[model samples]
Target: MRNARFEGKVAVITGGSGGIGAAVARRLASEGAAVAIGYRGNKDAADALVDELAANGGRAIAVQADAADAEQTQALIDRVVTEFGRLDVLVSCAGIEHFDALENITPDDFDRVFAVNTRGQLFAVQHAAAHMGAGGRIVLTSSVSASKAFFGHTLYAASKAAVEAMVLNLSAELGEKGITINAIAPGGTATAMAVEYGAGYLHPELAGKTSLSDWLKTQVALKRLAEPSEVAAGYAFLASDDAAYMTGRTLQYDGGMF
Candidate 1:
């Protein structure tokens, strides 16, 4: 990727309270884009982040909106444009993980994960695209599991698979309109969700018993999990004019997962 900038633009990042969402928000703001940070919960974290960014002369606002709710999702789009005057980019990072084998997974589990991860993202892009014209960008979060099956991650993997497929089709549908749609499929990222559900619980042996760092390092060919900032770097590229020619693609940010 080339050096990219978002000067004088506007971006909305869903699930912007913490983790990758917050990282992306800060990165975009630093590059001169006014950002709307949407979070379903974690007001303190979101508000504090907004304050920090504003103190640094960055434009940002924290909004409470559940991506899974179509009404609220549309409202989020309206609010970003209402505040910033125009919408240039939409990044849907809202997602949840419920790990279990196929037989152990429940219907509600499937619905809940898909509701926010896949369905919510679709509505967010739809509403954002409706408000945006040419040069609009849409980046959705996906996972390595979407392509490589992970044990006990049946539901979560399926949800990401849905996102990957939707983004491909969306790219084709939005191509004529000059709107680019793509996904960032991260692998072994150091997010709160990864710490809690992945390393902490699912792979406690890796987190507690041995050298956690070494354990995690061994899982990827590059010998480390990605920082959220690293993943956001890809988003920054996709949202910039540098990536204008790219669409219907999924950029994997894994450290070469083995």
Candidate 2:
């Protein structure tokens, strides 16, 4: 029998109920990592995914945890460790996007965005790092919008930029413990979050000029939005031994949007 890449590993994916998070959970489990999926409010979806993985002969479990809450985030890490015995990979894919003009952006909205996208991811790592030993890998989800200027994306962009910065800083801190920290910045993925943002909310200036779908295609060299699995593949690679030497860098999987 051919050996799987992660035969003896365990992985935890935040926001693993859907979109990129679900895709990553599937990918890691298929590669032989026992996976624990963390979801905020979608217990049904998370449970369904766990069933699907089991049907395919892969091991998986679902846990309910709000990433935006630090205590809950730490509990998530603890739950994964308890279930799988040890954690080898941590993929922080839980995030939110709030698109609104600067004049209309509320303090609460800004804080909420940062709470999930930045602060939550930071603590997830901080706590997960405790259980992760040598050869542990941490991959964060960032967005191409962080570096690109988009109307009404000030808060979302700022939060993601902070994520990338955290990846760089944590790499050095975690390196001494033999852990690798990195991020994947995707551009215009066709996830539910992206579709909602594209169809319903856009900058006031471009509101009626064109559809968000068409506008996004024109911006990407590929002329199309990425699939969740495509972005998940990058996460898989970064989590594997093949990327052991890589850390503190953000890989742009934006379909050449940069």
Residues 48-154 of candidate 2: C-alpha lDDT, one tens digit per residue: 99999999889999999999999998988998888879999999999987877789988899889999999999999999999999999999989888888877788
Clashes of 2: 0
What lDDT is obtained when candidate 2 is compared to the true structure? Answer: 0.91
What is the C-alpha RMSD, rounded to one decimal, of candidate 1?
Answer: 2.5
Where does candidate 1 stray beyond 4 Å?
A: 1-4, 200-212
Q: Which runs of model 2 end up more than 4 angstroms from their true locations?
A: 1-3, 199-205
Candidate 2 lDDT at 55 equals 99
* lDDT, each prediction: 0.88, 0.91
TM-score of 2: 0.95
lDDT of 1 by residue, 76-152 (tens): 89999999899999999999887776788888888899999999999999999998888999999999889876568
Can you give the TM-score per candidate against the true fold?
Answer: 0.93, 0.95
